[model samples]
Target: MSAKVQWFAKDLLIIGAGFAAAMHIGKLPAAIPILQAELGLSLVQSGLLLSCIQCAGICFALLIGSYVSKLGLKRCVLLGLSLLTLASICAGLTQSVLSLFSMRIIEGFGFLLVTLSGPALIRELAPIQSLPAKMGLWAAYMGGGVGIALITAPMLIQSWSWSVVWFSYALITLSFLIGIAWFIPNTTPSSQAVPLKSLIKLTLQHQPAWLLALIFGTYAGQWFASVGFLPTIYEQNHIAPTLAGLLTASVSIANAVGTFICGLLLQRGLQAKLLVILGFVVLIACALLFYTAKDSLPFMLQYVLVFGFSLFGGLVAGSIFAQALHFAPSPMAISTTVGMILQCSALSQFLLPPSIALLVSSTGTWLWVGVLMSVLSILGIVLTQRLFAIQPKTSA
Candidate 1:
């Protein structure tokens, strides 16, 4: 193969690994009903299952990132994929909720390793001119992985069982693990290892990194809360499992499309700040219309609103990931900065969905969920403005 083709192939492999890792997350929403019936789980317990995959990210993303930098990105990615493969298989065998939840927590660690390392590795591999577009593609991994899993898991579950879904994902992750090991070049670690304390200081001291963290956190929380529960929401409305999965998958795939477009726009010299602000505006409008007007509006219109919300939310994510490369204090700190952002993003994902579930349970309404999302979307707009104010003059 040509050298250019080789480079592109390696980048694709890394992104594929990320997508495989995310399938562990997407597989659960489709299985929630089966789990509730088979395991006798409560709605609160189901919410926990959905959010617990972020546990390691909530607590250890920065530490993992610091060590990943010292360990070499290729090695960390391999180790991450291995963990995911193992965890998925183990989760498939579990007969109790506690055992399954424990395995999911391990999956979170694996997810952290791949996601934190993938972008930094891409920055090292891609030409400067192609970096933004590549990062945008990297940003699409979650939505793409989740969308495919949502669509396929239901079919797998109906044909067999939820355990089959888990086992299938394990096999898929293993395939990517082997492909990455064979195709990607070994990444060398830095000559000197930075201490965890220093890595945290370097990442936390950068104002733009913190702003990016908050912006990503708000967007991720709202997006996950809305999209993650979509299957359950549709199920409550008496929608068939197959159709619900398709609708939810459509929303997620729209997010992937938005992120890819955001990348192209960024490469063409569109301002990241403008894209982010536009994303927030669309999110706010969508949240109000979808959550508040559900009974009055046509079902298709409601789906359109949420689909738009996710698509524009992808624009926010792609812009943030692209800009993060510019704001890192040093080459070694790239993963650290991304980790800090992921930590906050994980924090939001951890907190938001369960909170929404509990509120809906208590009040018998989804209205406050819209209010919460609007508040966060406004916060995202303010943070995006402040983040750009401090953008390094040399940034593209």
Candidate 2:
């Protein structure tokens, strides 16, 4: 194979690994009802199940990101996939809530390592000019993996069982683990170990990184809150499981499209700030319309609104991921900066779903979900404005 073809192949393998990792997340929503029925879980517990995959990232992403370079990127990626494969298998065998929850947290640790390392490895492989577009594609890993899992898990669960779904994901992830280990060359940069204090200080002091993290956090929180519980929401509304999975999957795939478009647009010299602001504006509109008008609007229209919300939210995420490469305080701090971003994003994902569940549980309605989304979108907009003010260069 030509060198170019080799690089492209490696990129696909890396992104595919991300997709497999995300399946562990997407597989759960469709299974929530099954879990609740079989495991005797309450609404609060279900919410925790949905968000717990982020627990590792919320607590340790920055720390792990800082040290991954020392550990070797390929090694981390392999180890992460191995953990995921093991966790999925163990989760499948678990007959109780506690064991399943423990496996999910282990899955979270695997997820954090793979995600924190993937982008930096991509940076090492891709040419400078194509970085934005590549990052955009990289950003789509979440939506793509989650979307496919959302659609497929329902069918698999219906035909077989949730354990089958978990085992199937384990097999898929294991295949990727082997592929990555065999095909991807070790691309870890040769660099002296930076002191932990210096890495933390440099990454923390980078103002743009923090703003970007907050922006990503706000967007991720609302997007996950809306999409993660979609299966349960549809169940309550008397929608068929298959149809609900399709709708939720479509919304997530739309998000993947938005992220890809953001990449192409950034490569074409569009401003990151403009794309981010546009995302927030549209998100606010969609959230308000979808949640408030849920009872009155046609189901198709409601789906369209949420689809738009996810799609535009992707733009915000893509922009942030692309910009993170540029905003790192130094070359050595890039992984740390990305870690900080994921850390904040994980924190939001960790907090928002359960909070929304609590609100919905107390109120006996989904009406206030929109209000909460709108508030977050507005915060996103304010943060975007401040981010651009501090670093006003238009080009990505």
Candidate 3:
């Protein structure tokens, strides 16, 4: 990569690790069709499979934060990547649905570790001037990785199988582990252990912490629920699988594009909260146009609207990451704050996909998905205002 691309070397490493982990996460949605065929998974089971990797985060984000802070970020990153490497390798060897579910749960723990610790690592290593831009890029990890995976998985699976895709991810994660070790400077793990009760008390005591977490959750719920099912949704409309994957991938990349723009805006000193509110406005408008007007409009128009929803909807993520740095109670509390947000985001991931799947399964249409997304966007708008109400305090 060019030095301009690696503006912050260590930050780039952390983002690279995150991108690989996200690819592991994103690989699943594209492979869902093959897994369903091979494993005989029901609609709910498919949704569960899509989200099961978040199960550990849902339950242990806060607790993991405390532990990771004690263990150190580098150690956490290595350990998490190792687990994913192993879990993906095992998943490639498995054929049974039960085995796949169990492996995903393991991957869940791995995903949680990298993501929760990554921002804190970036905050430590990044130059002051570059933090906002780096964080904005950090926010795009999921969308970018998922977008790439969505585009590539179909092509890979057509020649081979889902297991091969899983194996390829394992190799990729292993390569990242080696890169992180070689290129990233090492830091000693903290000996100090913040008591669990104290950590929770400190994080929960802050109002911005709660609001940030809620905002992240609501934003992530809509994003994941919609994107996770896009390929399937298009399939039902009789789009070719390759074409569907391409379109879905493009939508996700649009999210990353918006995130990149938002990052540049943050770097230029834009009001972070205002960006989030604008994002929610775009999300609501796009949802109305895409989800509600699908049947009435031409298919390509529907596609364009969904693309717009994701493109602007991405500003929420970038804004949230920017605000999160300011909202952190202290430098030490950054991981904790991130954990709390991820916990909320993970819970949304766990709940929203299955919930959306059930809605589609029960109602037999994508009509109400827009309504759910609209409600969440409205909630996000209300919550965004509260984020700016409190003057951000300096965290040591």
Candidate 4:
């Protein structure tokens, strides 16, 4: 019982740290207006700023995963949090766009390190029987972080600048770092002798890794492309900033709830492939209903559809996280599998958001947004089906 409690505590600590890292990602959307006013950024530039954290994930997922394997998960997590704390504090003082850009890249590296290590660490600590449930809960960390950040920023920025919010978040990360150090035991890597090339090759060779990574990319890209712009969209629609923040936060919270539900479903023997397919289908339907002819639709209905998009869309993440644990090529390859998924997810985030912005800029309406997302969702569904067909007949 004591061991189980210790594992549960460790899982919570890792999830908390991940939530804080995600807040660093989430903070930019809330501050877009302030950033535009201060730095004279264009819409596309703001999109780039919002996805700046993906830079590190795109460039270094495999590299960082290899490092985590060598350095030990606990050490890597500590190092990552330290990077976040320092970069966030420095970002609070930056006056130049170039400086802020640099800080964001550093922050990206920090985010990558913590997130990449988190799941593998949880798997290390938790009992095998509890892994599916634990991973499902772990999957909600990013959504919860984003939701909390969106809700809080409007209130914080009313009395203080976005920079002070950055500073305050740094303090938050520092507190998590201290708690993490005290609670989570330092576990050694499974093997120190494997070469990076071998790990990458092994990860790539795993059938489920490719499917999960691609699914994660598609779901994340579509989700972020929509949610990341919600604040700006609501602002343009003449909603109050606080209200927009509240609305966006509510949608994000729905996503977190979806992931939690997915976890429970997985524990109840819900097939992973079915969850992925269902999530994609729901996202497509919701995207169409939410974004089609936006000006003519009932405002309440549009909000409800967007909320549905987030809620059902969350099942994709929970399913992928739970399935990946079972599908990792080996115990040593779990971090590498996660890193690959994150790599693809980040690539989509970096590419899709800018593409979405361009689409809106050229078309002069969000109507086409649904069209784009529908195509992606269809592709996601096709890929998921292919993934299911290729798996062993007895496998979930």
Index of the highest-lDDT prediction: 1
Each candidate's lDDT (Cα)?
Answer: 0.87, 0.86, 0.84, 0.84
Model 1 C-alpha RMSD to native: 2.1
User: Distance (Å) between predicted and true CA of 395, model 4?
Assistant: 11
List the candidate 2 regions with Cα displacement exceeding 4 Å. Answer: 36-44, 232-237, 357-369, 391-396
Number of backbone clashes in candidate 1? 0
Question: Top model by TM-score, which number?
Answer: 1
Better of 2 and 3 by lDDT: 2
Clashing pairs in 3: 331-396
Worst 10 residues of 3 by lDDT: 227-236
Candidates in order: C-alpha RMSD to true structure:
2.1, 2.5, 2.5, 2.5
lDDT-best of 1 and 3: 1
* Candidate 3 C-alpha lDDT tens digits along 48-85: 78777888888899888867777788989999999999
Q: If scored against the real structure, what TM-score would every candidate get?
A: 0.94, 0.92, 0.92, 0.92
Worst 10 residues of 2 by lDDT: 387-396
Which residue pairs does candidate 4 place in steric collision?
A: none
List pairs with backbone clashes in candidate 1.
none
